[model samples]
Target: MSNDAPVSTTHAPQAGTHEVILEMRGITKEFPGVKALSDVDMTVRRGEIHAICGENGAGKSTLMKVLSGVHPTGSYSGEILWNGESAHFSTIRDSEHAGIVIIHQELALIPEMSIAENIFLGNEQTHRGAIDWVLTQRKAAELLERVGLSEDPMTKVKDIGVGKQQLVEIAKALSKDVKLLILDEPTAALNESDSQHLLQIMDGLRRRGVTCIMISHKLNEIEQISDAITIIRDGRSIETLRVREDGVDENRIIRGMVGRDLESRFPDHTPEIGEVFFEVRNWRVQHPVRADRLVVKNSSFFVRRGEIVGFAGLMGAGRTELMRSIFGRSYGNVLGGQIIKDGKELHLKHVRDAIDAGLAYVTEDRKSLGLNLLDDIKRTTVSAKLSRITDGLVVNEAEEFRYAEMYRKDLRTKTPTVEEGVAKLSGGNQQKVVLAKWLFTEPDLLILDEPTRGIDVGAKFEIYGIIQRLASQGKGVIVVSSELPELLGLSDRIYTIFEGTITGCLDKDEADQESLMRLMTNTTTRPETPAAS
Candidate 1:
């Protein structure tokens, strides 16, 4: 937040010191009516971790696909030079043959397979046309050690945490003798500790003379680990900066990615928080499967008529389970609890009862629980309010289309038509559709779970604006997000949850990343600050 301007480091890197490992020039890709990338250019040093920076739908993934041959040689117009030789990769296998490996944002490991099995799934060790299990386990152990992991090769992939699985992926790449590694948002789903460990592994790879290319939205990590940074905007290369000498400024990088200076990432909204209109008191619930375990124990929280409340917790802290249980007992059996809305106590037996009781829940997994991807936009938008758009004995199609059109334009969803399938829309637009679906229900309270997860910065700001607008209209909003900065930026008041219980609650003026994380991990106990005025 300093007033100083970002330093300029747009010139190319010094050539005499570090050699160029890969280069792409005049890369252009088009899909249907969209021009994804237009004559983009990129360069990477031999042993440096180069970071690709851009907002969502900025062609970052597309450009990487072109380099890795996912788009194939003839599919796109680009010339790639690998170690001073032309690279005409026709398939992913071709790039792998050249020692190039790409780990996508979504992990590709099978859950049922063991660590060693996933590492050498397709490229396995063999002797005389037979699979060699012993050698495979030994080699997997070696790869795991190289990545600073001590996991058992026999352990199933599903048994490990997401952070450990990421290391397993790196071990898989090492098995291929990878020279150049491309990781696309590798730490997006990982927690703070896991992210730090992943970065350390990347540093280890760099020491071994491996060239690394990382695509990430976390500016702090990019600033910390990247030796060179390339900024892409609107399907074009803006500039590249040497993080050490160049301004290495966060504001400068953000401006380049957004095409303009954003004075504040979160929109300025002073909420007029009214009286406590919705309250959950003494709520206790048992684990969905393990009846002996209590997931939510003696948890009590309240939301005002016009307020944005945030729940801060680490992974598996029972934040999502608590909210899901309240929204129609979705996750666990409610042993004893009271949901009082406007002084009326009610019991919600099913999701329909929750929706009918003026409550709407937008799940974290938009693709799975929020919307039916194969269904068109119109059907998804009016799904929660079918009774409002239905006739005596049938669904009124025209009424549904009209409602969908109103929300499509209101939320600014980027779709050719309301008839378009939800699957075809980008992550951001699909999220907007999910929001629109709930908005039509006109609920008194909205529980948004990880609303901005896996989305771009621009889209995140838009969603923030929607949340602000919703609160401004006297609707109680509760948000659950993994990103602490997001909770700090958007929440008027934050409730820190730990082990399925409310550990501490802090007002906006007193909340910080350190304090929130401390409460989330149960490091500090006493947080009794009054709510902000």
Candidate 2:
């Protein structure tokens, strides 16, 4: 089977006759003007992997938060029955004490801490008044082995990759003797190989009689691994289906989540190609911290007006570094390169220069590098081009609101008002706001890095439509995505990168998963393209 294929759980027992380990009755959680979750019900059988499926703003995360005591007992109206006993958790500690541990989407491990320290961070193995270092390392090693992680317990967390960090989190849960494990979008950011390994680990946990509640947008993975899936929509409990008995598939899950059948995963788009308007020649970038390490080698690519160009590469293959370096040198140091747009050479030394030169880049890490969580939607939307709304050092709030509201309506962002904080918005809505921020810049060339990383299927279709609309308007778009199917479905032309080099360029007609993988891994010889000259 392919690495991206979902792992099979044929060895696991069916959940048909399993005992009920947890039950949440009428979980109604509200935040200010939004009823995040309303009358949401969920039941998890002992030793079963139960999945929660929903759209971005459908309150999947909110329901998990309530269950894990992040919202506390009094913050919401709910009855949680654990092993047939009523339970009230006023804090995260209370939940953990009850063996209900939740690993959030954003990992909580400190980068500077060692693996052992991170495992027993809060629940340290103490010797009288001090921490027992020997005992901590010894127990952490045992837990790591249980999760199939070969890393030493004393190794620093910063030295490991995201895949390894995730294993550490599971080891930490095992340290707590957790009975119920809740994972929220755990594999959302993981690559195909890492995701498969994590799924296997979950299956392993299930075998040891560990009950898991997973919230995910990946329907294929959910269908393969989960014994039962509960669908939530519009802040309400829709229905729960037994995976095998009900014959639930991705289509059925999509119907439950979106309230409609999406006839297609991508919006139909026909490219109106023109002469190449943007070109990069001999572009080379060095690592930001390591001057001797070249992250992006001598690479070149081009984009034509009214065209959507896709970039395909393995993780750490310099796809992002190449785009970022071109977009105002936001990432690595430029060793050498020349950017040509419309037959004119341009020099961009900073982010402002890139924006002013009609270039916009939407970063992959939206929460950290793109949007300011503390700011309101109106401010975030107009932030990239505040000069347009500013007059003589004074800002025009009306203009800000007008632009924000316009994009919000155009993008179909789900929000009560543009005045709401971006932190309150869902992943898809947050991504739309990021796109709006760049669109406000009125850039000629837009570089999107992983535009739909953690968004749901319905939202992905909408985002694809937005990209096509931009291309239809005679704009040049460069899309960098890890999902090859996305590139295949949306792009007119595709470029493959391997180890910081542009390995090959293939037109839409010649590109496929197999051919792209060949070029991406540098398995075949380089192809001559206009950029290669």
Candidate 3:
């Protein structure tokens, strides 16, 4: 699609028709050295999907934590009124006692537990203090049905895909007799089809008189589903807009979020294309566990210096697997492949070898794979290339701090200090830190997987500029993204992947959402344009 895609004019149904069921007055939450939320006021109707929109580190999640009692009553100075009565919750259980349940951005389910066990883990139905398996399974089955899930209750939580896992989370919430449900970035990790299904489930819950407060960076989804939107910016509530009454669109919500109209979602740039610096030929990788299965087929692609090459694919289309395998066989067993960099084939047997070969891969799952959350920013920034900060035996602390501080300022990472733990920063800042880690390696080729996955529009714009800046420095950047629009906006050339195979390639001028979708789905193939391989 073009940049001028029409804003959705559709409004939510029955907006502002119900009575106010939840309200917070002058909520102020503070940490050791930071005030997360200040005098934030919000109101939710008896049954409506309320959305919270803001840039990263704008206190949306912090506000939700206060409401759900994650911060507790005495910890934050706030008066919460539920159903016109003062409510002071001292713990998460206290909020749940009042039928308030929140599903965090990161799932809290146990991988080893069964779906039934995970659903009623802490709130199990018991008979004479003994665990009642029959009742648990039956109730879990019913809840699953309510959420349109057909999975068996006995199935392991890790066995299901992310979409189904999300449904299981909702089922778990339903088991609590929840009256008010909160979802933080619910669809951030889901594909389009699964995201739509989750939205439909939320709408169904609204009809069942369940109030929902959702914190999301996806303004388009917010525009489509929210009855009312509350835009939070810089630790304060900016404005509350009713979808029907105000006719709020993406741009309007964005303005409230960033305090200015975004004239362009992407920055304008003229390409300074150069010779091909990296090439992957006939790449094939076997599944890590399943030896008989091939995760990546005979995929072939190349990246040119000063050019941003985008890989577009659906979820489970092997995009991540391909990149990981190419980056020193990190994902699967590399059956056969040729990685040619600077016109010379290189053998990268390990991650260290990949780094030595002047290649860097920024993983999509930053929380798990890209970052060590326990470490501080200074440490994490140089962890990928400790040799740069180390003098044979010991790490030079001053050099580490200098590099961290430089990247922090250069990438515009929002943080009080480099000594702060990465877990304390927002998703955008953490991503910046991850980039800094890899950039410290001083790679000639950079592979970024879902670089802007859960970040806001403003942060995404900044990331795009950063990618372009890398390309401008004569580095070859390969971006693998689930977002088609992002590929169109940033990539000079885009390649489509399907079922572990490279389907086709298109230049910036030739690719659009529909065309790319067609190629991605393996429905059609474009002419294979030769790169510098």
lDDT of 3 at 495: 92
Q: Rank the models by TM-score, top first.
A: 3, 2, 1
Clashing pairs in 1: none
Error of 2 at 75 (Å): 0.9
Per-residue lDDT over 57-172 for candidate 2, one digit per residue giving the tens place of the 0 to 100 score: 89988888888888898989979999889989899999998989999766788889999999999899999989999999999999888766788899888656555677788788
List all candidate RMSDs to the true structure. Answer: 5.1, 3.0, 3.4
Candidate 3 per-residue lDDT over residues 415-456, each given as its tens digit: 889999999888777888999999899999999998887789
Clashes of each: 0, 0, 1
Evaluation by TM-score, superior candidate among 1 and 3: 3
Off by over 4 Å in 3: 1-16, 114-116, 124-168, 523-527
Better of 1 and 3 by lDDT: 3
Off by over 4 Å in 1: 1-17, 107-120, 123-176, 285-294, 332-336, 393-395, 523-533
lDDT of each: 0.83, 0.86, 0.86
What is the overall TM-score of model 1 with all chains considered together?
A: 0.84
Q: Against the correct fold, how does model 3 do in TM-score?
A: 0.92
